[model samples]
Target: MQPTTRLKKPAGSRNEILTVGAGDRVYESTKLGAVFDMLINHGVPADVVLRDVNIPHQEVHSPQTRISLTQLMTICQNALRLSTDRHLAYRIGASVHVSTYGMFGYAILCCPDFRKAMDFAMRYHALAAPLATIEFSEDKADARWTIEPNLHAVAESALYRFVTEMQIGIHISLMRDIMGPTFTPSEIGLAYPQASDFGLPQDQIGCPVRFEQPANQIVFRSQWLDRSADLGNKTTYPTIVALCDDLLGDLKLRIGIAGKIRAVLLRDIANPPSFEAIAKLLDVNDRSLRRQLRQQGFSFRGLRDELRTQIALKYLRHTTLANEDIALALGFSDAANFRRAFHRWTNKAPSDIRGE
Candidate 1:
């Protein structure tokens, strides 16, 4: 069946609704900063986009910083508003280089062949784009690289199209950089519907663009998998991969004691660990852990409450669990207590948050 194009509500209409809260997905500032730079290159005022999104202009300059996904979406929405170019994503993506991704990109560039690069990307995608999931599958005739948002119920948002387009364009640009300028996907599939006004993607992607498909994917012949990448570097490959590994490991550690506590809680929310237990798990004594947490501006009870609130929102938005069951899962003594806590956390009833 031919896919129908889905137009999104105007950016202004959805801005407030899409604002992210705690526990929402985030992207590395380096990636978003690159997009911001591109917007400036296109003459979009930096102050205007930053002020609209409530992001400090200096924050994007730091590669180690992260920004919420909603903030990234808002910036894109503002970019579209301030610029006449509908192909902003593609344009920005086309300019991307292997270095833009830091060690992750270099790891790919160092792979001996396209197949090995694909394997590396599939294995370490989290290091590059934690907010999106990339899956690789193959049949007898063709290979597919499917991309989708990692978050639940995000594909319907207007930002999905822009992000998907930018990502697909980056893939195409990377492939051309590695395999040679002649390379192209056999076909491109997008979750969003086609728009006649957006004609440049078809030309830029150098393939037939199909919209409203089963998922966002790039299809190509399986044989291309074995094609040797021109930039493969045997000497530097292992070094770069090891560097990426260290970066990924550091990413976990950088999340801080509060983040570590949240992770522990999320892992076993029904029976969250006591502060003493959590400190032991983190390899520190309770007293030391408490001091460290205090230094980081976090308290154990506050962290637990925040985690519960985030989990409650996740359950309310993504599942049909009853209030009693949700309460039980969250270790509440009763539904009434859970309801009151939910209201206190969000200033809205559980049912109201659940839209029931």
Candidate 2:
């Protein structure tokens, strides 16, 4: 059997593999119209979704307002039927590039080394349009390019859309940015088999193309990872890398704060602390902490509740605690309160969560 590729699931138990900037995926002005249209057509209650985002039905049809990631996911959950199909998402993403940053983007991408350019793409892709993730993978002999979807309802389709368009645009731009649009990949692969008009552009460069692969990806010789032309755009690539490293660190804390907070809670389980106390320990103010969690696409209450629920379930399942004992252990006031809270957390009773 092929070695199983296991990825860490999100707190929501999502099986997605790509780490994406949730904020960046939303908030792109250019993508507002197409996404809105798709959502409305897909059976979401337009008014309800609009209310969730404070956008009116008319404004969604208008060209002025942008959509947020949260709004889009809510719509996808309620509307899009094939949101899980990764390929469809990629196809949608390919069309979004037109409204995104135009030629300057091409110039920046083509000028940088492969690694630096990839980092820039990941970091700023949200700024241009929040579609999918572009990441690099390397082994001893070859480098692979892959696309990952963000946490939208249409996770798979989104991944497909990102990989397809990104491969097409970046490949063409790579050569154009260097040698006036004449450069071409000696060999190319497309995960989706259907032909696109884009293949015609390869005629200009006389390169071989392959389609229908295991994943929407490209493989290239490692030697090509570096370029010699040295068109040197004056932006320091190393500085960009350093900046990406710093931002990634911040993102880790943001996304994984629940786990970090869980650790602290574990340490203080005997004497559960207040939110203010936890915020002070983490070196953030209460409001700032709440805002950061919101921006990072989560809530402090959600995290705390999840942690407490986990502890309650653990105690119920593994230990011989009565419901009242489990309640006390998890800092709840009493057995009744614990049962109500656990029901809220799992949509099942505490006993059900414990399989009792």
Name the runs in model 1 displaced over 4 angstroms.
1-27, 52-55, 152-156, 196-200, 256-356
lDDT of 1 by residue, 1-356 (tens): 21111111112322211112323333466556767898788776789867556667877767646765556656766766676677877776677767778788889989977888887877766565444567789888899889875442264465566667777777788777777788788999887777643433677677888878989998988887777677888888889877876664444333556657777888988899899989898999999999977855568887788778877988999999999999999999999999999998888999898775
Question: What's the C-alpha lDDT at position 295 in model 2?
Answer: 50
Q: Write the per-residue lDDT of candidate 2 for residues 262-342, one digit (tens) a residue.
A: 567778564667778988999888888777666545676776676676677778789878999887877778889988888
* TM-score against truth, every candidate: 0.63, 0.40
Model 2 global lDDT (CA atoms, 0 to 1): 0.52
Question: How big is the RMSD of model 2?
Answer: 16.7
For TM-score, the strongest prediction is 1
**Prediction RMSDs, each to the true structure:** 17.1, 16.7
Any runs in candidate 2 off by more than 4 Å, and if so which? 1-115, 119-130, 137-144, 148-163, 178-180, 192-209, 219-226, 233-235, 238-356
